[model samples]
Target: MQYSPDSDPSYDLKIHAGFKVVRDYSFSFDKVEISFKDMVRFIFPSTGYLIFNLFFGDDFTLRFLNYDLSEDLPHHLYITGLLSRGMLITGQQGTGGGYAMKIHPVIGYHFLRIPMYQLTDRQVRLSHIFDREGRPLRQLEANASARTLNDPGVKGFFSKYLPDKSVYLRDPVYHAVNKIISKKGIIQVKKLATECCMSERTLHRQFLLKVGLSPQSYAKIWQLHFTMELLKNNPGAKLQGIAFKAGYYDVAHLARDFREKLFVPPSQFYRDVNPMMQSYLDFPDSLQ
Candidate 1:
């Protein structure tokens, strides 16, 4: 059966995401993507499914972006599928995506069919907690190890946490195109694919497979997300400042993107946040 939650306010962005204390790897229906000029961040609930994250093209070094996963990889290190179990993401900004990983939505199920099976987590494999009745628990750490995305051995037990079509896919180009789109903020698909050394048709096929949005469409979403962060943190931020910071050549360009995606002027978003010191990543945007 096809599932559509577009009408469900619970999954909408009106409230944004508040803090979620880990129980036992919580399953989420909300797949989120946020942008900040050259920086793009994606947080998706692996929600019980058989999917993998495919990153391709280019590599970069990271600074404060490093995290304490079950293990650590260089910012430019390219690995596919599960990054690490128990991923302690701490803002990493590097380049390189020619890697992909097939992650089973199940707690610790590693596919026997992957290309890099030998390079998975060493000390701790993936596993899940369960209720007495056999339901998988959320964020349980009874027998936990340093978590990494690519758990080597254990398989997930529950089957109910799968994600929807829009949230799961198998393509390596989404990140490829995203690389350029994030840097440029917006571009035509054909032009983007051309720059990536592929036909527009191939580009579209791979992009839609992973990102679930057309090239232009994703760019709009990305720009809006980045703009939101900028405007949120800098309410008194000038249009020109936001524009230049967000990779636009002029304030007019910023205004155009704002009107197009948000249906409101950039200035309108300023009055929303109050001043406060905060852990930008750990704190929910609302605490501002």
Candidate 2:
């Protein structure tokens, strides 16, 4: 059931662009300890699965907050949901070694039998809900911290944990979700439901089960994400043009989304943000 590393195109450089921003860790599949570098702050949006972080760094302080974007207090080792608003992660940048991977949202619940609601929009630790399973997950973290990152070990781990193509194809909602993503969240819920050959209520329920978010909310997330991406990529382009291209009614509409999701106006965010940091959080290298 294991997938060959060679079969998949390399996403390492893209996924860990922030680490690369700070310093270059040449790609190598010989061992698991991917690198020894200082960690930087990056905010990962709910675009995909939960990422596993096994850091062996000193003075590491990780925290997760709600959609409220409160930085007053933060908790270490946070568990995020499919509709997780956003996360602001900060850590010391120094001698660290680790292995990390993104676990598909559906696979996490399907194979692990984790309830999506428990993690939805809440900022808590893996131990909170994974009470009995926490010990093993923590042990896995320990194991990951100890070993050097190698191709075989990484491939073996994913093959054991990730759902196969059959599982994805078997789910009816998967196709619907794919349709929404293909349109970049520019489609309507009713149309999506019709395309999926289901009623709106059924589509809502199915999306919640498979994606941990209502279809409307899921679409909004991608809309905002795409808008942000447009702004980031088109510096010389006019804001109005970007807004229209992103399917927003107007520049004000786009700004509203920016405020809601990023906790800042587009102008302020663009001025203060670092391109490298955004590349890490928003998406992979090519897309960013």
Candidate 3:
């Protein structure tokens, strides 16, 4: 399904935030395009999904825990690994647009053909991965626009890289991921290991290899992800209520996670950021 800001119930919130947003959830991977009328800064929360981002019209900077990364490539395409902590992104002033595809970590590992642990909390230029002469890179560049998700060029590029169905069926890590999602990140690691029919040590090793983060770390990120969703969807909801709904023990625990992972307090974050941008960081349920 495609969602436009105009047709969405949050249309007024998006317009007031100076954003034009489009989302397509029809495919296994979620695709989104967002345009900003002015310069903006926001905290994009940690997620289990590996993200591919294409930038146009302006450059952006990403600040992780200890270092800063910027996009300066001619094609302006980059793939972000599964983020373990929130990142602060700042876009330059003037009209700017970006397209992103959110991929499952298991599928991302198969597509990249490398140990996913090396990519944790990092971003790599797409040019380094794909030859400049390749059709995937060329098509992605040509279709990096407002209609990116629906464009034939983008779809054609992705078609060549889709993983096989057996990959999901045969991977224990993938099944664990589905269990984590279904529980909304509230389950214990020992229980998860038991349910997946693997020892805790084995589960940890496999999760790091396939998902770029350990099971505990991934669960924490997913918990924060769920909390963010609650905050975005319920603008007026109290912190205590939202925290409980997201499976936190209390509001203080939720606040601590925000400060630890996002580098900001919950109150300040909600007050300073745009709701539409917060929604953009959400991991879609369909992808699970």
TM-score for each prediction? 0.37, 0.68, 0.73
In the range 13-83, model 3's lDDT, one tens digit per residue, is: 12211122223223433333334334334446666678776554534322232324554332355678877
lDDT of 3 at 31: 33
lDDT of 1 by residue, 150-223 (tens): 32211242223333323323333534543643554545667678766888788665544443334555455445
- Clashes in predicted model 3: 0
Flag clash pairs in model 3: none
Enumerate clash totals for all models, in the order shown.
42, 11, 0
- For candidate 3, the 10 contiguous residues with the lowest summed lDDT are 10-19
Ranked by TM-score, the better of candidates 2 and 3 is 3
Candidate 2 ranges beyond 4 A from true positions: 1-48, 65-79, 83-94, 97-100, 122-157, 282-288
Candidate 3 matches the true fold with a TM-score of 0.73
Encode model 2's per-residue lDDT on 55-162: one tens digit a residue: 344433233334534221111234445655543443323333333434445555564456565556644444445567455445545454323333343334434544
RMSD score of candidate 3 (Å): 7.1
The numbered model that scores best in lDDT is 3
